[model samples]
Target chain A: MIKKFTSALNLKSGHVDLSHGGGGRAMTQLIDELFIKHFDNDLLRQHNDQALFSVPAGRLAISTDGHVISPLFFPGGDIGSLAVHGTLNDVAMSGARPLYLAAGFILEEGLPLADLERIVISMAAASKAAGTPIVTGDTKVVERGKGDGVFITTTGVGIVPEGVNISGNRASPGCAILISGSIGDHGVAIMAGRENLQFETSIVSDSAALHGLVADLVAVAPAAIRCLRDPTRGGLATTLNELAKQSGVGMAIAEDRIPVKAQVKAACEILGLDPLYVANEGKLVCVCEASAAETLLAVMQQHPLGRDAAIIGEVIDDPHGFVQMATTFGGRRIVDWPVGEQLPRIC
Target chain B: MIKKFTSALNLKSGHVDLSHGGGGRAMTQLIDELFIKHFDNDLLRQHNDQALFSVPAGRLAISTDGHVISPLFFPGGDIGSLAVHGTLNDVAMSGARPLYLAAGFILEEGLPLADLERIVISMAAASKAAGTPIVTGDTKVVERGKGDGVFITTTGVGIVPEGVNISGNRASPGCAILISGSIGDHGVAIMAGRENLQFETSIVSDSAALHGLVADLVAVAPAAIRCLRDPTRGGLATTLNELAKQSGVGMAIAEDRIPVKAQVKAACEILGLDPLYVANEGKLVCVCEASAAETLLAVMQQHPLGRDAAIIGEVIDDPHGFVQMATTFGGRRIVDWPVGEQLPRIC
Candidate 1:
């Protein structure tokens, strides 16, 4: 931490009050003592509403994500770390190296100050670990009943290196689809935390920043890679559907080749949910040319974050643009978007 | 509207559900039918997770703001337009020309689809009026009780012209302080709307984008201007206090010279609020050299947003860095940050 100002927050046993967001001395104390204390960088210490920086010569990619995950503290990661990972991954999916991030927080009145500090500490840690700092941010407060404990919105700015082009529309009929790792870990962990379900084995959320892995992939096959996406919210099935629709192509995914942890599979079976539709925070789905599949998968597995990477699907020519999956049971089914009973606030 | 995908939304009677944020077909429909339809442009049509655009080679200023204002619809401005204007102004405060914006929305489940559409339309209009488009966005839905109706967080990026530098710590003793227009319009309007107070004259929010006026000011006195800030939540009093503390200087202002509309002043009197400490969304304070004061004021007054512009005060040397106001009654008093009863969610 830069330690621009000493801690003046009553973090031991204090709760957030209306005045803390009143834009008065109280708000200043909270920001200086808490936010600036943790996210202290030269850009943030200027104490301006905006942060100024330089952008390299290249196309700029901008992305944003709103995280309202329930159970602020989850198994493998909390909302704080999840917020950083989610937005960073979004920017990275564009084949751009995330440069900086800006966060907007809405805190519910009466939220414990200790909890807020913990979240900030964890968020700062995640940012530092990812090498992307939270440069500028805003804080707002709503009445106790009007908001949950905390909702974080992160916006990221990134720069694509020269000669790199990535877009959903870039995917064609003869592309191969690959995933970074196992699916449904993040969603299952949050579900277990919220339901207080005791599993035979611990299932942790796979919430990690993927920009480093994305950087490596871009270096190896910058031209062959067509589109990149993180299977979050509605998970892998929905992600493929989005790409298929955008590219005006259909997909043929083999279920047996898809990677899924044994623990996550068991949990989904017990909960009567489809792992294909459950969210994953750390993993990524890449649609690339046929020539890049083998090289990309090898390069991806070389990275620790993508050790279990697999080539699970391929793009096919179909006017309807459907995503069909060959199940392990020797049956084929159209993998459509999830409709009902979908989890909310699962990030 | 680009009309990429025609409106498939059940706008008359539908309510938002978890599926809208579930990364499923519903979410796509909501995004394409509403957000894309209104915010359609070449960049947004890419349908990628992130928006990629060319940025000029220059300094970049980035900012983020979370809008949780009560009464989603206010008299003069709603939360939608306010979200865009507030963030653009923040970037403009740094003497930058805003280029693009990214929005993240947190919507409460069970909220009316009609209301969401209305807000999005208004937000699109605001972005269009300012010539800054919403290039990228994300939406998340929380349970009904966990969130209010809706909260929008907007992040903006702008390019600063060469040789123009603005910062909070640049103010100095003997500097001139000027304001764009009347204060307290936004706060008073919100208070009246919330309290259901029937005043003789209706007070409307002064919520407008200030980048055009900022551009003019920068063109006229780029190097002479020390710092620029919009008096938003803590109003002008807290803003001056912030500048004083930041620049390591004190301020002496003439209360009689600060422009406050007669209707807003009356409304404040009835509400026992100090117009000086009330919020103004569209107004801004500029600190510049004494030599540039007259020219800057003349340039500002030529703009519609600064028709009521005035030179209110000047920086004074004080070791304690206190802000003192010369009251209309010919006595000086310390202008301190408001301590309590701050109208929450004033945005």
Candidate 2:
């Protein structure tokens, strides 16, 4: 990622200009000083246009995600960390162990050098924490008005172990649905940060890497687990509906069995939003055979990222794949697919 | 890339709305009717978050590129085709056969649906022409003011055949340098489009996928091909400087032996841009043993992309790693590392 710099950079108060991304000495210097000094991997150090490696013949999973979230920094995480976690989780959903990452950055001209460095450092830390190295990357700068501060896109490669065959369409008529921890944390945090909400809100995004917890679940019941998916973007209800439709079935659940933090519930109610539709970054939905649900719950509860794991619903036989929920008042309502204007750039 | 659409999209007379990227029914509908319809493949039709595939045990190369070029549409291509070519070229530089690609798109609200569809169709055509498939992808939207039209990022995965080992650092002091074709087509085309230069300029970008050409060269003489690199953003002079520095050697060339098209030369002369410093998307620089130069030149000239191949320079031993050019005049001048402001977002 870097080359040996001939001089030091003015990172303290420097701003990115057109020359920094012009593929000249200035761009090389920035990479040498900022990117190379931090990423510091053997593959990146080669300074080649591509990173080369050898892998054994096996089933490999590849996922890509683009993060264009507003308010680059938030209560619990920044765009840099979120970019890494988002792609990693996507690859992990296949019950695969992420091996490498490739990132591409689009920076707007005049962005503060300090802020860019902070994001890079945060991204490196997140990758390192998850034991995945960014082997290759590309950077481009746009005109001042053509872009926001910065947009990051990450692609992850993972190798699924033998005997693991997780996919969204594997959910059948009798499988049970389980979640790893609470919901609405990430959505509520982004809303509070964006709106300021006229008070000191205790909301923080639950944007943690869930591959480790997924590894645990896959290790315990490789075949019994039907599918795994992170409840992101449109949140738990939307994800459930997707799974049911993909598997050609329906779902029924008890509202009391689902888990939600008190603060998240309060914030959603105040904002006129339903908790079931809000996003959760660090949580996941797991579908498995009903016989193995208890064993899987025990395994999930033993992990740090999955203490609040619960069996929220069970698959049912319905041609329309409707997700019906039994409310606390003993009333039944269908959980329809989410519709309407999206919270733009919410990661 | 797509899901089943409940209804046809508002394609002919509509613009992209925020809901199209909101991870709801609207987003799915857009993807189903547009992206999926164009980029349909067996792996993509599976509808998994990640694409799973198996490969033979071998060395693999990966490259990532973000295309944020201005004037999204130009003479030879748009941002979509450029995105595919850019990354495929990067992987081809390693003497690898590109097999799969993953794409991420960031769309700005209010973008015309017709323009987006045009770009998507062009990208799908490019991918098909190159024999590589878009296996998995993602989409995110930013508010109108936060982005320009659209930016695309692509990552490529390729496998290197046995006995072909290429690296930037493989050039020795006694190696020879060669170029595939003429320079400055892409840079001149972009300049003419952006500045609306006076007179009818015949310049068109030479953006192309070079894996087929590269495979021919590697197949003929795998061991003699020491290093291969495409002169994209930095052009021929800057690319030579990078190779010299990486190989810890110097380079000397005769100006009369270099190849340049008549139209590109006239355009560069009028625009006050040096053809040697202008970018060329479809060109490449090869460094190999002095003994194999003629054979390699013959091999390159036999291919369509390398018909104008020429032996431009020879590597030399020097502590400073300078690239000296014997000019048309009687003097020798050093081609120093390019410094100063750059032409941003050219490719």
lDDT of each: 0.91, 0.88
- Return the TM-score for each candidate structure: 0.97, 0.97
TM-score of chain B of 2: 0.96
lDDT of 1 by residue, B11-63 (tens): 98999998788887788888888899999888887878899989767799999
Error of 1 at B208 (Å): 0.2
Q: What ranges in model 1 sit over 4 Å off? A: A1-7, A196-200, B1-7, B195-200
How do the residues B1-347 of candidate 2 rate in per-residue lDDT, one tens digit apiece?
12335667878888888887778778777767788789989787766789998988889899999988878998789888998899999999999999999999999999999999999999999999999999999888888888888999999999999999899888888889999999888988888888555446888899999999999999889999988999988788888988888788889988878899999899888878888889888999999999999999999999999999999989998778888999889689998767633477898
Q: Spell out the clash pairs found in candidate 1.
A: none
Report lDDT (Cα) of residue A345, candidate 2: 73
- Please write out the lDDT profile of model 2 over residues A27-52, one tens digit for every residue: 77877778767777989878888999
How far out, in Å, is residue B159 in model 1?
A: 0.2
What fraction of native interface contacts does model 2 preserve?
Answer: 0.75
Cα deviation of A34, candidate 2, in Å: 1.4
lDDT score of model 2? 0.88
Per model, state how many residue pairs clash: 0, 0
lDDT accuracy of residue B311 in candidate 1: 98
Q: What are the DockQ scores of the candidates, in order?
A: 0.62, 0.65
